[model samples]
Every structure is written in C-alpha cells, then in structure tokens.
Target: MDADTLRAILDAQAMQQQKAFDAQAMQRQMRHQKTLDAVMERMERMFSAMGATPAGAPASTAEFVTNSLSTRLPEFTYDPDSGCRFDVWYNRYEDIIANDGSTLDDAAKARLIVSKLDAATYARFTNHILPKKTFDVSLDETVKILKELFGHNTSVFARRYAYLRTQRNDETIRDYTGLVNRHREMAEFNDVTPEQMKCLVWICGLANPEDADIRVRDLRKMENNPQTTLKELSAEIQQFVDTRCQALRKPAIINTVWYVSQRRPHWAKDCDFANKTCHDCKRVGHKKGYCKNFTSKKKPIPKQKRRSANNVVTARPKLLPPLVSLKSANNTEINVRGHFNCNFNIDGHEGRGNCHEADTTSLLGLDWIAQDEPLFRRLTKGAICNVSASKLNTLRTSLTKQLQKQFVTVFAPGLGRCVKSKAHLALKPDAKPVFGKARPVPYAALPRISQEIDRLVAADVLSPIDHSDWAAPIVVVQKISPTLRRLLYWTERRTQATPAPTSNA
Candidate 1:
C-alpha cells in the first residue's frame, strides 16, 4: 500500500483501539467500585454479628462512661442485667474495632492489594484516567502536584500561573509570551523576539484558537515568515501573505465568500509569484498590469484612411451594393435617341388658335414649336388613315386644345409651360415654327423675391435644406407671398418624404 493510505489505516485503527480501551477501563472501574462497595457491606455485617451497636444509635449510660476505656478488661461484677456490665463489655469492644478499622479502610488496605493487580490493568488505569471536562483543582494545587510529580522549577510554575490568568480572559491573543517566560531559565529555551511575538498575535487574530495557553511549537510558525513586520501584521496579514508571497511549499487555492485573499485561478496562473518570473507580457517582479514591458509594447499607431482601389471618393454612397446591382441591371438597355424639331404648317381650320411666341432668354421660353412622333403615330393609327396637311393641322389643333385645357387646370395663372432651360436642351433643331414675342410681366410689378429669400435664410427663419431646426427663428411676413410659401412647403414635404439613413448602417 502507499505510505499515505497505510498511515491513514493505522491512524483509524489506533483511534478505535484508544476508544475501546477508554470504554473498557471505565467499565472495569465501575465493576471495581461495585466490588469495593460489596466488601464494605460484608465488613459492616461482620461488625453487626459481634453485637456492636450501629453508628448514631443511642447507647446506654454505662456504655457512654466506658466508651473511652483501655482495651484491657478490669475486674467487674457479674450481674447479667446490670448497666455496668453492658458498659464494661461495650468499652472493651470499641477499642478493638478502632484498631481493626484502620486495616479495613481502602487507603490503608491498598498497600497490600497493590501487589495483587496485574501490570497491564494497573498501567491502563494509571495511564488513561477518565478525562476531566473542567479542572476542579486550584492552580496552586496543580503547581504543587507538578513539583512533586515532575520536579519542574519555580519558573515553570510562575509561567503557568501567568498563562492561566491570561486564559481566563477572552481568547484573542495567543499566550506566546507566557510560554516563553515559563522556560526562560532553561538553557534550551530559545526566546522569541518582540516582532515575532507580534506576528504570533496577528496569527492568533486570524486563527481564533480555543481559550487555552499557546504552546512553543505554535510560536515556531513565525519562523516561516521572515518578512512579517509588527506594523504590517494584522488579520489582513494572512490575506497579504496568501495573495502576495511565494513560499517553500505550494499553498492550497481556497474559495470563500469572505474577502477574497487570492486572485482568481486564471489570474493566479499569470501571477509572477506563482511562475517566479513574469510569463505574460514579461517584466521583472510583476505581471501585465504593472509590467513596464507591456506599457512600452502598447505604443499607439496613427490611423490613416485606407486608399480605395478606384482612388476616388465623392459623397458617401447612399445606395447598398444589392441596390446598385439592381439599378445597373435595369439600365442595361438604355436608349440614346436624340430629339428633332418639327413645324405644324396650318391650312383652313376655324378653331385653330393663334400661336404666341415666348421670350428665348427666360427659363420658360417656348417660341420654337415641337411635336411628339409617338403621340402623332398613335393618333394616325387609331384613325386608320394617313393625315393630309389641313386634316393634320385640324387634328393637331384639337390635341393642342386638349393639352392646354389640362395645363390651365394644373398650373397657376401667368406661369407659362414648365420647360427645361436651353442649357439643358439635348437637341439642335433643323426646322421649327416661329411666332411673335410673348408678353412679359413689367419690372416695376416684380416682387424682390431673391433678396427676401436671402434675408429669411440669414435670419435663421428658413431651413438650409431640411426644415428640422425647430429651435431656429420662425419665419414671419407682414403679408403672405403665396408663390414663395408654396415653393417652401413643397420642398419641405418632399424632403420629409425621402427615407433617412439606416441608423445601424
């Protein structure tokens, strides 16, 4: 068997044997006491057989007078009924019993019986007396017995006396002082220093040992801690030692809900004290948090925006990759046809309205006549006939009347066709109808709209792009400009209708 297992088995057997021996001894003592009581009773019966009066029984007057007499009988009268005769007999009897009682008492009789008991029984009885839960004997009596038994000196007695006195108080400090003082006179006693004594007291605070005198062996524990200081040694000293110090033997990693003394297991692995050198982000005497190497290694790298493959960036793309793919797919078959101008030369048609030219410089200029070939083709196909010039003019007039009717309903008065500016025109016309100049609004009658718009924007009355700054100054006008209000309202509505950026993206 392994040494530890064998040791454990031996310990368990020894404990069982000790317990059995204690129980057997107690039983033997009880039996022995019963036997002693029986012997005492037999002796009392023997005394009764000899006509001795029982103790505390009333005696005759003659017996009282003769009770103190010598054992030698004096010459006496022979009257059987006389009190003197009974007294003479009783007095002689008492002296003989007194001499015999000395031999009968166990303390006196033990000298004779001591030779009869076997060595094993005697040894067991002597060695293992029943344990005393409390010490009924006085300290002085204990000292006297110690002196008689062990021949220990006065210093030991004095130390014991001091220890007992201190033990009577609450057990906080271990009585290391008392143990040292007791053996001071002895050549072999190695006294503890004051610092070591303080360390012991600090250990006592952590230990909470039972209210008993501390022993010399327990004070020897302080020798293990060479670095413990008097000021630093407190209950917290154990925590510091368990956490910070490296020792000859490995300490058990303990878990408790009380203040954590040790670092976590993972942290302990990285601990310098455990490894004896810093393994993680190595530096002397410390692990990562306090490591100089770690601090130096963490030099910041300056961030630079990575150059793109195209090396071009406008505004950040609002479209997703999948959306861009879908747009590309839909635009694959783009038509690049250009526009050409057309003229509507009129013939006889009474309902044909007079054509008016528009100013070429204005953004809404419409002097050149245009036609939609797709619409004309659809009209001729629906009629199932090719149109002659007069007939075509009549049809064209009818279509123009229809378009004008719809346009008047949709647009405000004095606002001409909403056409693209000449800068935006895609075609150079070959042939087109010409007309007289269209009338313009007088300059005097024009509102200072652009100046008013600038003033409104500068006052923080108008939003830059989004009308979302509610805290800005409110737009106030003496009289409402319907055109300007309409324009601003439509812009605000359209801006709000568009989707906002995805917050997560």
Candidate 2:
C-alpha cells in the first residue's frame, strides 16, 4: 500500500467510528427524553388529582413538564387504629385519586382501598366482602358495608336523648344552643322544624325554672313570629336573668322592731313609775314637797336617818359597842353557829373568826360588807340568838328590795325545762361495735362513783340501758386533787375499732 492511500483509509475509518458513536449518543438521549416524558405525565396527573395547578403559564412542553414534575401529592398512610370511620378514609382517598389524576375504575378503587388498609382492616374487609364474591364493589358500596359494620348508629339515639336532656348552667346560651343544634344534626330527626328545635333546646337548657310556664308562653309567642330570631330570643332570656339577679341583690326591708313589738309590749311603755318613792318622806306616788307626811304634818316629821362613812346607822352609834378592842384582854371569843365564815385579809390586817365576831372596823374597811350591811348582819347573826325586831325589819327590807329588781327566770329540771341537741349522731354503714372490758372501781371510791352516777342519771346527763352492743367502759380519774373525783367515759375504746380498708387500698 502506498502512503497516500493508507492515510485516506485511516481518515474514513475514524469518521465512520465517530458517526457510529454519535448515533449511539442520540439513541441514549431519545431514551432519556422518553423516560422524562413518562415521569412528567405521571407527575401532572398527580398534581391534577391533588387539585393543584402550576404556578405560572408554561411557554413550552418542557417547561410544562418541569412544572408538573415539581408538584407533589399530600403524604398520607392508612391507620386502622385511627378510627373506623369510612367517610374520613373515603374522603382522603378521594383527594388522593383526584390529585393523582388516576383513572381508577370501581375495581381499581377497591383494590387501592384494600392496599391502603392496615393488616387488621384488610383482613376484615376481605373476610366480610370477598366471601360473598363482592370483591369488585364500587367505592360507595364498600363504604356502605364498612359503615354498617363499624358505624355508631345504635349509639346515636342514646346520644340524641342525652343531648336533649342536657342542661346549660355554666355555658353561654349561644354555645349551648349550638351544641343542641349539632346534636340534632347528628340525630337526623325527621319532620322537625327549626322553631321546634329552638323551643325544645330553650326549655330543656334553662337552669332556673322559677317562671318556666311564663317563659314557655313567651317562647311560644316568639316561635309563632317569623321575624323573631334565636339571637333576639336569647337576648330576652338574658335580660330576664339579669333583672332577676338585680332583684335578688336588692336588700329586703324587714321590720324586725315592729315584729318584736307585736310579739311583746315595749319595755319603756310597760314600766310603771307610779310606785316611785320620795327621798324626803320615803313614801310612794309623791315627791318630797308633795309627800302626805310633810304636807299634812300629821305626826312629828321623822328626822331623816343619816348613814356614816361605813354605811352604818349613825343615829344609833352610841347604842352599838365599840368596833375594836383597845386592849388585847378585851378581845372576847363570841361563838356563832352558821355556815358564814369571816376569814378576810384587808389592808395588812387579817380578820379570822366567826361572822358574828368579825371586827366591825375590818368589816367597815371591806367594800362588800359596807354595801350589804343588812344582809351581812342577817347572815352573820348567831343561829341561837334572838334577832331584834329592828334587825329583822332591816332583813325584810333588803329581801323586798332584791325581789323588786329585774331578774332572769331560770327553768331547772324540776321546773319542766327540756333541752335537745341540734343534730343526732349518724353512724356509718360499716361501723363496727366497740367492745371493752369494764374497769373495776376502787373499793374506797365505789360509794363516790355510785353517788356521781346517781346525780348524772337524775340530771338526765346519763341514762341506764340494760344491754348495749357498743360499750365504752367508765374510768374514774382524780381532778384538782385526789380528794376530788371525776367519772370519765373512756371513748378511746369506742374509737379504736378496726378501720375498714379504703377503696384506694
């Protein structure tokens, strides 16, 4: 071969190799474009199914394809535990199909639903429908079957009744009415009007029925008027409530004084001043100048008796003995038989003796003795001594004065007084009888205990029973000193019963 021929042949072979490589690259590009076209078509269908459109107008097929590929379907997965509501799943699947622009036939939709079902739901669907050779059912038919299997239709009636009976105390009228309407919708009652529903809800939801009849009448009138809205009716009801609250807040005028006066006479009006005495003549129904003794001068006007600093009769000062002895030898012992003792320490001086022998100087220093000298003398006089007529007269005057003063009337047991407890003790259902061994009373204290028991029984503080299932032993305890005894009803034994286990336990 020649050099020129060899060079031309080499060029032709290189060109042919390059042409073959170009043809293979063009084929690969065409394949890639076909794959991309298929992908774009699928994405466009998905975006259409999802109800989404491209953001802007595409100038070319490539741009349109690119935009379509960018669109995405919402991500959702079936969950059996989510709920058994077929409507919810159906709606979601419907959106998915629409977004994917899927031309799913009834059978295809059924298959898609089966694929989306969780294991349990899938098994259930197949077992229930496939057995009847109903595999190729429509979406609606599948939903119907599923609904019949899991639908809460049975509970709807119960819920409706419960809803109707519900009252609205804490919630607003509008909120309560809204709940009622929602429940009514769920109940799907036939031949019910909006007016009827509103009236039923109003009547049922009213917390206060003080004027229920009147309210019902008003509601009926409103129901008849087509122009009256639920809002207007609610406003009226709210106004009524406001007015009622305001009326209740007003202070009630109670004539307590008038009522008491009606029950009893006025104290001032009932008081009688006619028996008041005059200080001048010591006589009733007249003043000092108008006194009969002073006006008539029937007898020598008795001189007004004067009292000393000790409130003792100064007119008879010379008649009484000296209050204190000047010499120790003159302190004679005077024995008096009486319960009154004169053991008083006054002004660093001690008076220690019977009431009759009490030092008059010490008694005069004592304010109590000075104010009640007549009573003191009467109480201190020896039991065997003959009381003089004048002293007896003084005692009578003191007694009469005390009797004339206002005093509270005390009704004792003997006077037919009775007392009752406000509330009686209520024992629990599970209460157990408390049993305790009786404590032995001390031999020396037995008489005292018996006397105390007798006193309590007589006073109705304690009652004797022949037998009792619940018994708390009596315990004697010393109080103040060993000489004083108190009978105690030991309640520890009664309260120590084994407590029943609680619910939490």
- Please, what are the lDDT tens digits per residue for candidate 1 over residues 1-505? 8999999999999999999999999999999999999999999898886566554343343244233332243433223222223233334544553454333333322222222223332333233323521133343443233233323232332332333334325333545565444334332224546665555554455433532223332333344454556664444444544554475457799876866556655565565465455677665556555556335566554444334423456533232222111113445533222222333432321122223222222221122221444444554566645555768878998988887654442433432322222223222244232222323434653365455666667544554674332222222233466555422211112122232233473
- Scored by lDDT, model 1 comes in at 0.42
For model 2, name the residue pairs that clash: 45-100, 46-99, 46-100, 49-98, 49-99, 49-100, 50-99
In candidate 1, which residue ranges exceed 4 Å CA deviation? 1-121, 125-196, 204-241, 244-505
Candidate 2 deviant stretches above 4 angstroms = 1-84, 98-101, 155-157, 166-185, 189-505
Report how far residue 209 has shifted in candidate 1, in Å: 11
TM-score to true structure, per model? 0.12, 0.23
Supply candidate 2's per-residue lDDT for 343: 62
Tens-digit lDDT string for candidate 2 (313-388): 3332122333443323567654332224346554444555434333324234344454455655765775566545
